[model samples]
Target: MFFNRRTPQSAARPTGRLRLGTAAVAVLGLGVLTACGGGSGCSSEAPDSTTIKDLVVDVLAEPDSLDPFYRNTAEAQRYYRLVYSSLLQWNEDGTLAPDLAAELPEVSKDRLTWTVKLREGVTFHDGSALTAADVVHTIEQAKDPENGAVWLAAMSYVESATAQGDDTVVLKLSEPYAYLDGKLAMLPIISDEDDYKPNATYATTGNGSGPYALASLKRGDALTLERNEDYYGEPMKFETITFKVVPEDASRIARLTNGDSHIVPDLPTDQVELVTKRNANAVTVESNVSRLFAYPSMKADRPTSNTDFRLAIAYAVDRQRIVDQVYSGAGRPNSTYLTYGTLHHDEDLGLAFGAEPDLAKAKEHLAASGVELDRKFNIIAVNDPQVTSAATILQSNLKDLGIESTVESQDVAGFYANLVSGDYDLILFDAPASTSTGFAPDYVNGGLNSQAANNFAKFADAEMDDLLDVALTAQGEEAQAEAWRAVQQRDVETQGNIQLVVSQSSQAWSKQLVGYEPSALLWLNTLRDVT
Candidate 1:
């Protein structure tokens, strides 16, 4: 019964087998809790990894901040899920299920209104009962135009959030949004109390109804969490969980082999074989969701603003070469905007830029663009090893086309700053894997559309925006398919952003961890079920 509390297998990929670790735990009993108070965000140094009795997860990137209101990085969301609970959860099969909510919301016939019922008796880490007001407050904070909420664009359709009573919330929308349920899964509920408002102390602290309580934080080094003993749902397997930031791949592998860490996520494909050879009990799993793409700055004066120039950049890069050399053949070259796991993905669309490099066509587009021969370009990317390697290849490809460019490597913070400033000619970015393809609408609208807060590329096209609206408002699957296909077709034609690689996600965990399930989106929300 070591894996007794496993969640149901995703219906989307029922045939996909999960490789489970059979390593026996030396001790099954709960360990003593950490001394820090829950949700205090207390500062402390990390314990010696080799000496810790509980779980220690080795992570590559330290989250920029703990505040979900402003921090939108995948790493931040992973930490947020530990400290807070949302109304719904996205399963690996792309289905939505109730989490804090008593059940799924009842949608109106027009799909403009949603009535949500709260689960009774659920209390936050502060011992306050969760109610409809908390949900309303969270939604309002997210939808506020001036709040600078990370999810503001995702909640654009929401017109109002009002509490019907202690347990019921009514949400009104300006227009029909089929993906409303998925949006609910993104907003973590917090108390309506003013102390927890945006930019308050709550940014560094926690007051959520999740299974784990934030015990202490060492900031960029590590964070320690203790199980919320008063959790209404099934208890977390480990009494304490520590997440240590290990940026180097070698160091993370070293930690895993030496038994200093129980799990190490974001394993590079090239290092998978090395980690498995070092530890027989180490179990690794792969998921198809990490989308690597290029965002060309579409500022009016930038050379990349020219559609022909963008298409030339897209066609010149050898995607298959990047897949083989950079990813160790663990990824596929994608030509269109949508990835394999996404809904309405047309395999036969045959994008303008094929997987293989077409130097002749690239030169033709480059000639048509009439870009100055001596113009230099700037390429921005995170300091990740694979990303830098791919950027180097792109630089080489552009050089062959008589384009001069320099690759600038930056940390996560610097990367985002450069991305939003519209100063760079082109930037390489990754969209973290998601369980729900339903987020496609928000991804298109918020990340790529003109006037969007996060539209770092500055891509503006009236037609694309109209296509996004159709995709978001489409009711039936058939209608949605048509709308999304039109959107993808337009993306291919305009080259607003070039799709690069659909990489597989890899994670290695110790055999001592039982019921350790692999997530398609790498959310790791099932840790509560892992003993």
Candidate 2:
């Protein structure tokens, strides 16, 4: 799931059901791979091996919930994807592909009606067959405002869903939405037998048609999964996979080095060398996940509401220094919200602000804003090491310009509360777009558009709204890309949110792990292909 910094609220009613296009017929196949090894401390020879049965993974935090509707954080979504299969799947290259659905839905000429064909022979973990009714039920729960689905706003265009037969499901939409397929790709389909009610407690186990079945869950300590023999798709290589929650970065790295854990995700940049030095078999995998920043456009009464003041903050940030010092050279400075390879990334638009800090220009813009320099502002961020470090750096930089600012570090939940309540002058946050959906209008619309549910910045502009409309409803990809480029250009000039850097998250795994691929989307289910 995308990283949302706000709490879930009552979702607005969807205008109509969203219709999307059919996917190609190609079914992805897995291939065996040659053994490869890397890391530094020990000799290059591979470690003595034993039969691979269980694969242990270390994560920073345990999932707050197993229920798809309640699990909003990226950490939770990683586990959710393993237990529940969606109608659509995102390929590593960011293309939408068929999952439980036999083929993509067929959209009507008006682009309002969509017919989806369910795959045959797929069974839930409980041995029940998947059907159109299950799809309908899952979608209904997701679209219902009472459910408070984290991604509810993305489905606001959907109006209704109906089961045509045991094998087919139909969707009706209010308007032509080009990215509807991508939005639906993230909706994990659950079985009708599952107790998935609005605002209910997280289910201890999941009943879905995925390759993995929940074996046991231990809340914040660990959760284990076993391969489902009756899965409809390719068989999982590992019989059991356990995700262990180790919140401390040092402990996580220690587990990987000590062979207690075979894989660890989100390894801090500063720990990369330590892990390699401790274990020769540890391999570091890096993927550019998102752009990190402090959004300052939340309240008009705040000094940041002034465009010049926001620009001053943008120009004042030494992005390279942040990347070097905070990330320890693990990330690259970025100016746009979208990642480098995503569609309509606007290379030129982000470059307008320049990569390096310009203190003189920042001072000039600050002077032009006419806000009182002595006014102290609050900078809020989650108490993560990197984020807080970056916040501290930003506070010091502002102080150098005779600007008074105070840093406030909060836990994840508290930080999200501050974000939704508009309680901070500068908010340190990050928004990651899935490779499949991030290339569309959803990223910008969610973060920058005036009425977007995730628009914590409270940015509103007529031209920005118009450009987004064009991008979402445009008839062709080229036209849509062009319109989105216009949106980026507008954002760069407006400085609604200053993107400090493109963040790169590191994943370290034992060299014995094979066929594992690091993904920008952070799909932990990719482990199914590993041996």
Candidate 3:
């Protein structure tokens, strides 16, 4: 899924490049032979011949699509950061800065109109000049209903985008959104917006204006990228980056320890020290924007549709035990849907369940559910080590309540497909909200509404929908906070989903890498700054 389909080769060296099928390296254990050797793409050579200036990363899975308008997977979002440039960019400290825009947007006194000036001398990878027209086209396509854009909900407030001249674009908003700049930071500017539809050149391969460009890709195997020498911003320190597909956690950790790769993200908590003990470095970046959550299927035919049954499942599980055992105590147990860093979350909000299990309360809810003991609940999850471990713990917790259940693990693609189809009683996964504005208007308004496309749980409630609308459209901070609190209280009472804990973003890098920093807003985009 990393690239379009390509034929396999033993070891083909292009005119000036050596292609290493890294997906095969997992079985061969050839750690040292994967270096980019004396290639034209290698602008400068490393001091050691075994490793070059190129950054080799071991990733778990390939993204389903490279198009920004279609898929919003974590892997694809990181790829977009490398290949595309946005109107605004977030600084490491979570401040907004100009990227493609000449400066911060100029807002009207009423905060309804936004005026942006495009930067001059910037060019797309396809050699087209970037202008205000591209920006207008991007926003129009994103907000259009016929496009079926994944970001349609986030762009609802944007009424219209019009270009004044060659360099200026103006936006008219339906309401005054305080966080509109943060949303602009997430929108990537694309060239030739006329061809930005599905199955176009921008879908299979990226044509962007960022620091990197796709050189070659072998589907499900390896991806090779070359630095954009004509980039307008600060050039990438590394000349090229090679992403190797290594699905097994142990193999990925071993590759990092043996100096096969420079960076590996999402390391298992127990294996963090293994890389640190060696010459490598391991870091766990804490983030409250993302959380590990369990969402119950709210289909009317399913037993989990009952509020009492859902609450019983929520109260029966011991979140503290799961946090300690599965996560190595790196996170805090949470009972509410929103994390502490989410917009409008406060200490006085709803937390219907305790951190530890309450068996008596669980029994009371179970008796009130009227669910038969013979019905077996099917819990679905991805086939990761920690995810499977958490599923087992939840399985045991349900057994204690005289309930029968089974854990069904699938690969990432299958897991997401099943989740969207609503074929399971429960689904467990991590939700990474990669925006500086937190998870309020986008995830809350889109992921929980009954008729919304991303509402995977099929949860339907008119009051919940109204509360979400208030949370998104409210003008003042106090009004927004009050609406968010009401939404959480309703969420707790309904138990549409169970929030488990806020997990830390963990990764390990080789000591040879320098100037690396952890970022909650920009995950691997920071790699451009690392040498």
Which of candidates 1 and 2 reaches a greater lDDT? 1
The models' CA-based lDDT, in order, is: 0.70, 0.67, 0.68
Clashing pairs in 3: none
**How well is each residue in 1-531 modelled by candidate 2, as lDDT tens digits?**
111113211112122123111011011121111112323213445453345688898987766567777644567777778778888877644457789889988999999998889899888888888899899888877777666665565666678889988999888987787777877778888777666775354456678778888899987689998989998888877888898988888888877777788887677756656666675233233333546777784566788888888888888887777778877765566666544435555556655666677889899998999988456888887667788888888888788777888998776567665566666788887544343323244566766767665566677778887877777767665676688788878777777787787655666777556445554454564665454
Q: Give the clash count for model 3.
A: 0
What are the clashing pairs of model 2?
Answer: 16-158, 16-159, 17-158, 17-159, 17-160, 17-172, 17-173
Q: Model 2: runs farther than 4 Å from truth? A: 1-50, 70-72, 121-129, 145-148, 191-207, 280-287, 364-370, 373-375, 431-441
Question: Which candidate would rank higher by lDDT, 1 or 3?
Answer: 1
lDDT of 1 by residue, 490-531 (tens): 887887777777665567766555445445444666565554
lDDT of 1: 0.70
TM-scores, one per candidate: 0.86, 0.83, 0.84
Report the C-alpha lDDT of model 3 over 75-194, residue by residue, as the tens digit: 677677888898987654445679999999999999899999888999988888888888888888777766656666667788989998879999999877555776787777777544
Candidate ranking under TM-score, highest first, comes to: 1, 3, 2
**Which 10 consecutive positions of candidate 1 have the poorest summed lDDT?**
19-28
Q: Which ten residues in a row have the lowest lDDT in candidate 2?
A: 19-28
Best by lDDT: 1
